[model samples]
Structures are given as structure tokens and as C-alpha cells.
Target: MLPINFYGKPTIGGVIGFLFLFTAFMRKKTYTKKTKGLFIKQRPEKKCFKCQGFGIIRCDLCSGKGFVFYERKYQRSDPCPKCFQKRYDMCPFCQGNGERSFLGKTGSNKYNKKIFRIFE
Candidate 1:
């Protein structure tokens, strides 16, 4: 048995044990929130400049008429090979989605101002 007051000071072992218990009680754990469905990383997206969010554009070969008229054979019209008589083709710029994805805002501002290219 040991005296309650040994030299009027706490033992080193007592102090160390108290400190370990204090730190163990104060420690914290972190957890991530659970969400439904598979996780998908989001990225910045902007409207396509060429299609202007319409997803399609007039066919260049047919000029939106779906057929081309030739004067060599008494002015005969034929379906355009490029558009297959649809008169419009999927926009290559946006891949028919009318939207483009980018990693950041760098140079994205230029796309905000609708700028469609003209073809003759």
C-alpha cells in the first residue's frame, strides 16, 4: 500500500495514464456521406457554338433542300448523298447533344456568345 500523499505530488505513472485517457476520449473519426446511385464526377458543360443547342444543322451538300438540282439532265433533282434526304445532319461539334463539356472556365467564355460558322 502507498500513502495518499507521497511527497505531496502525483506520481509520473498517474499523470501519464490520465493524459492517455484524455487524448483517447478527445479523438474524433470522420466519415463520408452516402448517396444513392453510382458516383459520377460532374464537369462544366456549355452549349455548342455550331449547333446553337438545336443539335442539328443544315446539310452542306443539299443546302437544307434535301435534294440537288442539276441542269445537265434537263434540270433533274436527286437526293443528297450526305444527308440522305433528311435536310439536316447531326452537328459534329456537339455530337448531336448540343452541349460540350470542359474541365474548367479557361476559354469557356468565348463559347457563351453564340458564334455559328457559315458554310457556302
Candidate 2:
């Protein structure tokens, strides 16, 4: 009988186990008909109001100059590390993606829907 060494070179049994694991890992998962439709529909994306779809904004640190002087001296200036000399930072509101979900209801009833449903 071949000695089973799980850590070392695979024996026949080990090879079989490996094949079993590999096949299991490679197998495609199937979703039931009911489950396939259970996922929430994605909301439409819109340009971020804060960044105006630019994905970046004026860096507060360098004031959009892309660099700053060590002590307001023209002789010595340091590249703005915050924006990598790009003069802009990732939009805090959009996280640099430049878009966000269009909030509130959509479709025909969107205009008719009351802000406070409890009052209706």
C-alpha cells in the first residue's frame, strides 16, 4: 500500500483527492428559477452632483496649484502628495467613480408618490 503523504508529492489516493477537489471547484453553480429573480434590480446611475461627473475635485491642501512651497518660498516647493500633483482629489461624495444611484422612486408613479406615505 502506498503511504499517504498529504504534504509531499501526491500518491494515487492524493491525486484522486486533488482531482475531486479540482472538479468540485471548477463545477458551475446553478440557481433555481425563483432564486434567479430574487436579486434586487440595480437603480439607474446619475452624475454625482458634488463632482459633476469629473471623479475628482480641487485638492484642498494645494488649493489646485499641484504643489506648495515649504514656507511660501518660491525657491523650495513640494509636489502635492495628496493629489499626486494632479491638482485634484478623488471626490469624497462619489469616491471617484463619478456617478451615484438616482435616489427616490422611478417610473410613472414617481411624480404621484407622496413624500410621507404615512400621511396618505
Most accurate candidate by lDDT? 2
Model 2 residue 10 CA deviation (Å) reads 48
lDDT digits (tens) for residues 62-107 of candidate 1: 8999999889858899999999999999976666766663421223
Candidate 2 stretches greater than 4 Å from native: 1-45, 72-75, 101-120
The global Cα lDDT (0 to 1) of model 1 is 0.66
Clashing pairs in 2: none
Give a tens-digit lDDT track for model 2, residues 1-120.
Answer: 445686877688867877788888997643223445684322225777877766678999999999976855447888988988989888776666667634322333543255446457
| Count of clashing residue pairs in every prediction | 0, 0
Q: For this target, which candidate reaches the highest TM-score against the unseen true structure?
A: 1
Candidate 2 lDDT trough over 10 residues, lowest sum: 103-112
Deviating ranges (above 4 Å) for candidate 1: 1-45, 101-120
Model 1, residue 60: distance off in Å is 0.8
* TM per candidate: 0.45, 0.41
- Reference-based lDDT, residue 74, model 2: 48
